[model samples]
Target chain A: MSAVVSLSNVHKSFGAVQVLRGVSFEVGPGEVVAVIGASGSGKSTALRCINALETVDSGEITVCGHKVHDPALDRRALRRDVGIVFQSYNLFPHLTVAQNIMLAPTCVKDMGKAEARKLAESVLARVGLSEKADNYPEQLSGGQQQRVAIARSLAMQPKLMLFDEVTSALDPQLTGEVLRVMEDLARGGMSMILVTHEMAFARKVASKVIFMHQGKVWETGPGAMLDDPQTQELREFLHNGL
Target chain B: MSYQFDFSALLPYWPVFLQGVWLTLKLSALATVFGFVVGTLCAIARADGPPWLKTVVAIYVETIRNTPLLVQIFLVYFGFASLGLKVTANTAAVAALVVNVGAYTCEIVRAGLESIHKSQLEAAECLGLTRTQTYWHVIVRPAIERVYPALTSQYVLLMLASSITSQISAEELTAVANRIQSDTFRSFETYIVTGALYIVLSFVVRAAFTLFGLVIFPRRRKLGTAI
Candidate 1:
């Protein structure tokens, strides 16, 4: 099976600190890959590089056929195929939930207003937020807002989604709400790469699990590999995270 | 000295005072609209334009902000004369006021643009919004909305400062008041009346701003809270 996303020996640094040191990974079509790591492990940086949010210092990243590492890469084209949701749930405060989802379709794709509104409605319904379409981001709870964020990304019909610590800011119950929505997407066979601290969610929903440490992919295997970690680093990480 | 105050002495010049008020309003309206447009463009340039453009906007903002409005008006009015141009005082006045207020509006708006979090911009980028679309929809529109109150305050001060153009002999409120005071010799009563009219004008302007805000920013109106 062909991979939808691939990275080979990607290197990135911030000033003097090297964040991603020769990291590599791949996500096949319909693969749900969970990247579990401690803080400062460069997992977020790798995910950001996939979306071209941060350029790789040295190496190759290809996402949905776009050569992300190329200097003349069409960034907007790359973005059209990839959707990203941040931990902050960065919804435009001035727009309603429906408008937030409709923005890109109308502006980038030039969809008609009625069509965009219908698309927004369907996506909001997917996240079970149909009633809150007219509500502003501030009016919703943290969980509802994150679901709306998911729906906003879904409006673009992106082939791949990137979730960067999306549940980190939420309480256990709110996190459960967001995780449930993500699990639904995974069950529906959407390709996703998520950086998470939730060991249990990663274990249940992820087809493959990767453990990143010291700016590299330290260990990778099926979800069951987490229970039988070969590296002492993964063992200690699972121990402390529990 | 017990001086008798007669406000009624200035009542005969009501028609003149009304015309002055109307002219002042027109000057302020034109300046406010053009100044805001210029300020918004300048704000966007300073924030993301090329280095040369940013430097040009910076110098303009600094130059106008540091100089006196009176002197700026004089320079604009007489500067055209020196160039052997036949510009009227009112034209010079509007040009000077727009230039002056545009600089201040640029600074106020740039602050609003900066206050937006980087994450918001990242989201816009992820959605594949072009630079113009991103700036208009996510950056400038919201930034201007955020700083609307400050912009309103600046515009009110601009209207008051329009009185300074009277020195150039523009036929605005203060100029009309100048003629009234000299002709009636009730300079004391004339100024008192004009000052009261100025107070009324500022209030009306503020009220209009509030109504305009209600129309444009549905989010603020719907939320029933300050943006």
Candidate 2:
């Protein structure tokens, strides 16, 4: 199959500040591509563009065969084929974990209540939170809430999953728990792309690593590229931990 | 010390006072229900309707909110009379109260609706919820839940303001009190009784609203306090 996602010479701006400038990359099926960069390096904006959350200025972005930059695109159809988990968890606080997981399935896919609950239960088990189905988002710990958010997206059965700094808000210990769930998903052969700052985690799990700096893709290679970065910027970024 | 108090003179008018209380309660109830409906609909339109529709709702809200409720009541009651409509005082009273309260309710509810964070709407969209689905589930219900107390207070104020309808001889509590005072010639005692009844009615409306909040938002108790 063609690349699951492709962006070529993409350009985006917020007023005078251009966030993404001439960015280009592609993700193959079942491949875990980790994008590592400093804050405000346009990594998050690129992920949002994939989900059609941000309209592009000029470029080509195709995700799951939907033209991301097209004005006539059916966003709901595109969203159905791709799922995204945000840094803040963003679970509906008013809803129980099971209801949050079942929301998309029942409302969008027209799944029956019993079937949706069964689906919710099964996904919750995958994330190791089956017992917390009835708990509200605010009642759970930060890591647990992030895991439930992943399960909410998983219930949609999207072909591609995007994670935008999902561990940014958690402490080191909590980050480990969320990472474990993600590693398991990667092992299960789910096509994924994640924007993350954890260099060790990216090297361990990402099949391909993309380094972005100053709104440009600075380097691209397999996970081993971190050990032998050809670009001086990547080496300096790794050394400074920025 | 110039005049003597005579509570005894108003004793036989208790039945008339009860009738006034009953009519006032009925009028208050009808206005509350319809006013809430009208206000919420207007709020939704102002928040998310098309530009022209939003403009229309804005004009209605500002027009009513800027004018005195008494003048609006007169416009509904006497204005309809001049038009050869001849609407009963009761009908005009409810209509006037509804139109007046609806504007205030619209402003209150619109504030609630705007308080919802933009990120919540983004999450709902990512979940593939249609526009209508997002509005009801993610925006309206949660917004209203967040602002339930504000709405309860607004409706209670509307109930008190219903007393103004008595000017048009709607036969509500104050109007009934007027007839009793005239018959018994005891204005002080009659007004004293009416004021106490108004206080009781306020408490009753508040308690009723608290119970209603409990019903529509059963999950609120589980997640947090009554708010």
Candidate 3:
């Protein structure tokens, strides 16, 4: 029940524009926190900052005991504890599904091929793509490819996983398959923080829901927050399909 | 007056021509292998290394790419002799070729590297892969695979350009042909045979690269899709 990720007064800017302006939130162990907002509301930027994909210009942020805001942070160690899935699925196109899943374990962890292959098999099964062990990324559907990407991240055995609008690129049917896999992960007690536009999935699956607007957390409560919003930004964001 | 064509006059020196063909193959093969390695490394350095290293690689790439291959061979051949390096003409030729092709390869591979989206590197980093590991597994290998066709074409062109090395007394295919023509006074026939050999050599080189591409990029072959 302890916090696995915590961000207090986080600020990040890209050149002239400030993407995240004093954003703050936290997620406890086995908690699914969904960040929903408009495109430029800094939801994705906040999520990226958790993995140190974007450095914080100010404020304190910690994930899995790593001080992400610190300049000399051991990023590699921090990354080892965090797995992030992108909207693009980012699978190594040259590698088969098993190879893509096995890549980090074998190369980073120095796991033997046999052991890595077994781990890949288990994770692929977890994503319900056990039959796609030998298929290339281009050979699979978008949903199936996204599932493989999830399995690829899962193969690293990360302490926390981040999903950045993973289903944003998929059709509704394809999105359902990917969402189902994520729902299973949530049900299995995986610590997850996702930036998503899927209000239904966020309301149904996220234990905590954060509504961001203009680079700050405008409203935060349980999944029921979507039903009754205190802030105008949250109400409008929920009313309009983003 | 109708001129009679006589390739028979040059048939006696088939073994000599074959030797030249073999040497040309060796020169091209050695250059391609070494150049690919050097060029891929340079591309990586140029794309992601430290600012100073990137600047150094940039200078190397621009210098080599802007100059002519013939000039590079002449410089390498004469420069080594001037410095008392004592390298043979073949060694000079290969060295020049490796240097020349390395630059072009660097540019081609760098283009491939640039085409990779930022999300891929972020994913690699989030998976806890080290910089070296990421470059090798995620960046360089896939970049090379994507640009394999361009690299292969550049190498084949380098093979054809090996003819230019004849000026430095490399004794490769063209030099051997020149010698045969001078000795037999059958200039047209000798050159016609040499031209045929060069064509055959080019096909052989292309086949070799195709076979290599199939082996190295198994996904490209198996999936029959763009990597």
- Name the top TM-score candidate: 1
Which candidate tops DockQ? 1
DockQ of 3: 0.87
Q: Encode model 2's per-residue lDDT on A56-139: one tens digit a residue.
A: 999999999999999999999999999999998888877789999998999999999999999999999999999999988888
TM-score of chain A of each: 0.99, 0.99, 0.98
Candidate that beats the other on lDDT, 1 or 2, i.e. the better one = 1
**Candidate 1 per-residue lDDT over residues B41-89, each given as its tens digit:** 9998999899999999999999999999999999999899999999999
Per-candidate TM-scores read 0.98, 0.95, 0.96
TM-score of 2: 0.95
* Every candidate's chain B TM-score: 0.97, 0.95, 0.96
Model 1 accuracy (lDDT, Cα) = 0.94
Listed in order, the DockQ scores are: 0.90, 0.77, 0.87
The residue-by-residue lDDT of candidate 3 on A19-95, one tens digit each, is 99998888999999999899999999998899998899999999999999999999999988999999999999888
- Report the lDDT of model 2 for residue A236: 92
TM-score of 3: 0.96
After superposing candidate 2 on the true structure, give the runs of residues whose Cα lies further than 4 Å from its correct spot: B2-5, B8-11
**TM-score ranking, high to low:** 1, 3, 2
